[model samples]
Target: MGRKRKTKIFMIMIAFVLFLAGCNFNSSESSNEETGGSEGETKQVLNISTTADIPTLDSTKAHDGIAFTVLNNVNEGLYRQDENNEPIEALVTEHKENEDKTVHTFTLRDSNWSNGDPVTAQDFEYAWKRVMKDASPYNFMFVTAGIKNSEAIMNEEMDTEDLGIKAIDEKTVEVTLEAANPLFQSLMTFPTFLPQNQKFVEEQGDQYALEAENVLFNGPFTLVDWTHEQGWKYEKNEDYWDADAVKLDAINAYVVKDPAAGINLYETNKVDRIVLSSEAVDQNKDDENFDTILEPEILFLRFNHNHPVLGNKNIRQAVNMAIDKKSLTDVILKNGSTPLDGIVPKGFFKSPAGEDFRDINGDFNTGTVEEAQKVWETGLKEAGVEEVNVSINIADSEDHKKVAEYIQAQLEDNLPGFKLNIKAVPFAQRLEIEKAIDYDLSLSSWGPDYSDPMTYLDMWLEGGSANRMDYSNAKLEELVASARTETDLEKRYQMLLDTEKILLEEDAAIAPLYQDGTAVLMRSKIKNLLVHPTGASFSYKWVTIEE
Candidate 1:
C-alpha cells in the first residue's frame, strides 16, 4: 500500500464506456443475521466479492487464485502462515528437519475432519500420492517436484507408492527429498500440500469436491453452501482443532465481474468489502474506508510459442519492449499497481544477505521506444512477414478487458501494420484457453504460492504445466535445477537471479506489465482480517465482526 495518486481524465472515460455497455451486475448474497440480538450486537459474518468463479475445489486439480482462496479457508495443512506471514503449526504440533534438510518429520495434532474422522498422518501421505498419481487435466504434481521420487512418479516411471513420504504411525508423518530445499517448509503452506481423507475421497468418487456436500473440511471453516459460479458460503467449523480461535460465524462470497456492480453492493450496505477498479479508485480514494493493498502478484503477457511469429525470439523481444508499461499502469490502471519490467515483483523477496532482489538485477529490456520499434522492424523481417495478425486472450472481467484493450492499442499504434484481436472469455474458459495454448498472447497474472523465488522461476520449465507459453531454455532450466539443490544461500540466490535474466532479458519469454496492487473498501468494523504478501489473500481465523 502507498500514497494515492490523482485521477486522470482517461480513467473516467473507461468507466463511462463500461457503464454504457450495460454490463450485468448482481445485488448481493443473503446473510444469516440475528433478528432479536441486543442493540449493540452485530453478526460475525463477512460479505465479500470475487472477480472470477472458482474452477475447482479439489486440492490436486486447483491452480487458480479463486480456488486457492476457498481451499485455504476450508483445509488445514501441516503448517499455515499467520498474520505476520510466518509459518506456524496448524495440523502438526511441530516439525523437525535433518541436518541436510532432506528429511522432515511432523507430529499431528488431534484434529478431525468435518465428518468426525480423526485426522491422521496417513492423510498427508494419501494427498501427496494422489497429486502425483493423477497428473491429468492438471499437473499440480510439479509442485512436489523436489520431493524424493516425485518427478519419477509424475513421469509414470515409478509407482505412486514409491514416493518418499510415509506415515510412521497414525500421528507421525515423514517426508524425504531428493535434495536440500530451503523452501520445503514454506511450501507446506500451499493448498496442494493439504491432507485428504482417502476414505471420504474414494466414497465420493467423481463427485468429490464438486459441491458443498461432496467435500469435507478440516480447517477453520466448513463449506455450508455452494451455488456454482454465483457464489459460496462458509460457516465456522465446530470440529476444527483450533475452532476456538475462529471468531467469525460465517463468511459469504459472491462473484461480481463488474467493478461498478461491486461498488454498488458496497454502497447499499450489502457487502463488507469490495475490490475496486482503477476508475472506482479514482472516484473513492477520498473515502475513509478505502485501503490500498500491495500484492506480490505480477501481471504479464504469455506468448504461445506455437504461433509462427511469436515463436521467434526476436519477435518476442520486440513485443516485450514495444509496449509502454508506464502508460498502461498510470493511465489505464490508476489503482496502486506499478508498471513492471521483470517477472518477479519488487519487494516480494530478499536475499539471505538482506538486499532487494530487484535492486540486484535492475530492469530488463528497458530501452527507448525508438529502439523498440527498430527491433520490431528487424523482427518482422527475420520472421519473413510483412505484417502479423495476433490475438490476445484475457479474462472477461472489466479490469482485464481495459488492460487488454490498452495493450492492443499500444502494439497496433507503435508497431506499424500490426493487427490485434482481443478474445475476452470467462475466467474458467480463459484457463482452458491457456491450457490449450489456443491464442497468440494471453494476459495472465501469478500470485506466489510460497515465499520463494523458485515459485516463479520454476513455472516455465520445458514441460511445466504452468508454462502455458511453452517457452523453454536449456540454460534457464539448468540454472533452476541447480538452484533447487544448492544448500548455499548465496549461490542459490545468484542462480535464481541468472534465471530471471535469461527468461526476461535474453529470451523474452513473457511481457511483464505491472505488479498487482488492490484497492479495497473494507468495513472499518472488521478486525484481525489478515492479508499476506504471499500465499492466501485473506485469513479469517482470528477475524471478528465487531459493533
Candidate 2:
C-alpha cells in the first residue's frame, strides 16, 4: 500500500527528550522506582503519539499509514522490511522460483497467532484470495505484481480460487505470476499481503478486525487495547516465532492532534515522542532530541474532474499554476518540506539511467502571478463563466488547516474570478468524503507502497480505486499498463516517465503541493525504532528503551 498507498494525515514521532525542569523528573523517577530499575536498566515500555486515530485494523481494507503501521506490527506477512527497507523473510522459512521465474513457492515458518492458531500456508492462500474476492482497495497491487489470473479474477472473469495462488501443503504455498516482477518480494512486505486465520475471520464475520479483541495477531506485537479516536496499546507477542528479537515489552500510542498537548506529554514523562508542528519546530529545533525525517509522501490538491468547473482542463491548469507552493512549504510547512511541481518526490527513485526521476521530468505547472492570471482568464473564457466557486476538503489538524487556509488564499488572490471555500473535517471523515468523490477538491497525500515510481504513476489509472479525482487519459492508462508488464528495465522506466508527463503536465490531474518532512522530538534513550521512507513508516519490533 505506498505509504499504504493512501497516506493518512498523521505525523509519526519516534524518539524523546527529557525536560530540564526539575519537577518534571519526578514522573521519570517514580516510573523507574515502580519498575525497580537502576541507572542502566532497560525499560521495556515505549510511549508515542499519532496525530489521528487508526481508521481500521483489517489488513485488506487498510489504505492509510496509521492502519498500515498498526497492521504491520500486529500481523506477520510472508516477508518483512528490515531496518534498511529491504525485504527479509518473516513468516516464510524459505522461498524458491521456477525456471521461468514466474512460479514461486514459500515454506511457512512455525508461528502462532495471538489466539494460538498456527500460522500456515493456507492462511496466506485464504487471505490473498479474500483480497481478490472483496475487490480490496489495494487489489491493484496484485495486478501490478503481475500475479497470474489476478486481473481476471478482479474483473469477475475468473473465480478467486483460480487466482494462481495455492497451498500446496500445510506448510508450503505456491504462487504463479503473469510475469516476473522484480518488486514482488518488496510487495510482500506490505500489510495487505498479511495472512489471516480463515476460521477466526469467518467466525467474527462482519465484526472482524473492528477492534483489538476481534482480530488475531501473528507479528511481534499484539494489539491489547483500542479506544477508538483516543488511543491504543500493544504488548510484545511472546508466542511470536522470533520473540527473542523483540525488545519493547509494551507500546502505548495516543491520538494527540494538538501539538502542545503532545509536547506537554513528552515534558511530563508521559510520552517518549511527539511530532512537532511548524511553530513547535521553530521552538524546539535547538533541543537535543529534535530530528527531521524526509518521507516520500507528497501532498497535493485533487480536482474532481467530474465537476463542471474542474472538468475544464484549462481551469485545472490555471488552478495548478496559481498556487504559491514555495510559500506554502517555506512558511506554513517549515519542517524541511519542499515545494513540488510533480507527483513523485525527489530522491524517491532513480531511472535505469541512474538519474533522479524528478530531475528527468523537471518542473510542471510552475507559473508566476502574471502567467497565472492569463491562464485563469483563458480558463474562464473557455468555461463561459464569469467566476467559479469551489471548495477544498481538508483534515482539521492544525497543520492541514493552516495549509488549506494558505492554499485558499493563494488560489483566490492569484487566480481572478476564482472563489475557494475551505471545508475542515476530521481525518477519517475527510478520507471517506474524498473516496466517495463528494467534494469539489481535496487536500490529499500519498506515500509510496514500495520504492518504485510505479507506486505513484499507477494511482491515476483510469478506473483505479485510488483515482478518486475522476481524472483519466487513454494515453496515461496505456503507458502505465505497458510499464507494469514490461520486463526491460529501461523501457519500463521510460514508460513511467511518459505516464507521469501525461498525468501531470498534459491533463493536470492533480495540483502538486509539497513533499512531506516531519520534524520530531525524541528521547535519547530510545534505540532502533526503524523508520522507513515508504510503506508502513515505523517498525517497533526491535525498538529498545535504554536508561
Candidate 3:
C-alpha cells in the first residue's frame, strides 16, 4: 500500500522465497554487431531498457513512477532529497517557517529558464495556484486544504491567492497555511509538488502535457520530443543549475512489456538496461553482472465494490480464500516479494507498541479458505446469485499478463463453476479503462507520494477517487482523516491498523496479492549512475559512462 511497507515486504520475501531465487541470473550483455543504419553522427545516448514505458511527459498527467523517473531527469522541484535522503535546497536557497508552522518563506535562486528568463517566485506561485484549481487531477489539493480558505478557493468561491501563497518579491515568496504540517517540507520534494509554468498551462489547458515541444524545464534535463503514450527521450539541459552531475547525453525510453524481448535486447546490446523475468532470472543466475534491488511497489487485485457480486463482503471473502498468495510468491515470483497478510503491508509506520498496520488475526489467506467459504455461500444464497463469472483487468506487461493467467487458472480450478476472464490491455488503454470503472476487477497498486498513511487510505474512497476502484467506506475515511492530524508516527500507525482491519473484515473491496519488488539489469560499462534505496531514480548530473 505504501512504499516503506512494500519495500520491507520485498526484502523479507528474499528469505521466504529463497528457493525460487534460482531465477537470479546474469548473462553477458555484449553486442559485437555493427551499426550501419544511421548516415549522420550517432547521438551519445545512455540507453535504458525497461519492461514499462513512460505514459506521459506532462507532470500533471503523470502518475506512474516510470514517468516520474524521466521527469526527474527532465524537470526539478523547489527542494530535493540528496543521497542521504535529506531535503536540501534545490530551487529555493532557504526557507523560513512561521512560529505556528502555518506559514513558510522561501528564497529562490537566480536561475534562468531554458529560454533565459529568470526563474522566480512568481512562477512557483502561479503554478501552485493552477494546481489548486478544480481542473487539476492531483491530490496535492488535499495538502493545500490547510491553507486558509483553500477549500472554498478551490470550489471557485473565492479569489486566487486567497488560498495562502504569495510572491513577496522577484526572489522571495511566502506560504501561509490553515494549520501546522510538519511533513510539508518533505511533501514538497514530491513530483506532485513540482512547479509548472502557469502561463503555459493556463493557455494550453488539456493540450499542455500532450507534447514535449509544449513544455519547459528548470531541471537536469529537458524532454526534447514527445509522442504521447509512445516513448519520449530526454537530453541534458545545458542551463541546469547542477549540470555537472548530469551524465547521460540523452535517454531513450520505449513503451514495452515483453520481458523476453527486453532481455534479448539487453543481451544483444540493443538496450543497456532491461527488466528480467523469473524464467530469465533462473536461466542466468550465474552471470558475473547479476544484480538485485528491491523497490517500494506492489501488484494488488482491486475488487470493484460497485459490482453486484464483488460488492458483497461474503463474495469478496470467498474470492480471497480461493487464491493462494504464498504460491504466487514462493513458486512463481522467485524474484523477491512477500505474500501480503492484509491491505496494509508490513514496514509501514509502527505503533507506540510497535504494532504493524496489518491485522494478525483476521487476515484471510490459504489457511482461512474454509472460513471464507461459509461467508461466501451465505452471501451467494442471499443475493440469489447462481453463477459467478468475473474478469480481471491488467496492463499489457509480460508479467502482468502471466500473473492474470495464473490468477484466472487458480480461481477456475479452485472454485468450481466460477468463470474467469482476462483482459490484457496496453499501458494507456488500461489506464483509461480503469478510470472509466469498466472492468469487473483489475490489478492495481498504489505508491505513496509521501510517507504518511493517508496516501494509501485515500484510495479506498467511493467512486474510486484515486484510481477509480469504485470503493468507498465511511468508517475507513474517518480513520484516515483523524490519522493525518497525528504527528505521532506510532499512534498514526495504530490508527492505520484499525482502519485496515475494518476494510479487510467488512469492506473487502480489494484482494491484495503480493508486495512488489522490482528486478532490473544494468550494463557493466556504465559508471556513476545514482541509484538510491528508494528505487531507480538516476541523476545524470553526477553520472558517467565508460568508453
Top candidate, metric lDDT: 2
Q: Across residues 49-78, which tens digit of lDDT does each residue of candidate 3 receive?
A: 555656666665566767667767777777
lDDT of 1: 0.82
- List TM-scores for all candidates, in order: 0.92, 0.93, 0.85
Q: For candidate 3, which ten residues in a row score worst on lDDT?
A: 24-33
lDDT, candidate 2, 6-104, per-residue tens: 333222222223221221222344444544545777768888889888988999888899999999898899999998999999988889999889999
Tens-digit lDDT string for candidate 1 (1-547)? 3334225434544653453233222222234343224556676778788888778889988887888878999999998888888888898887898998888899998989998999999999998888888874334433434788877776678899988899999999999988776667777787888889999999999999999899889999998877766677788898888888987777878777878778766886667899999889889999999988778999999999988888888777777788899888877787788988988888988998898888888898777767878888888898899899989999999999999988888889888878889999999899889988888999998988777787789888887788987789999988987887787899989999999999988888888999998898988988998887666777888998876
**What RMSD value applies to candidate 3?**
9.0
Where is model 2 more than 4 Å wrong at Cα?
1-40
The most accurate candidate by TM-score is: 2
Name the TM-score of candidate 3: 0.85
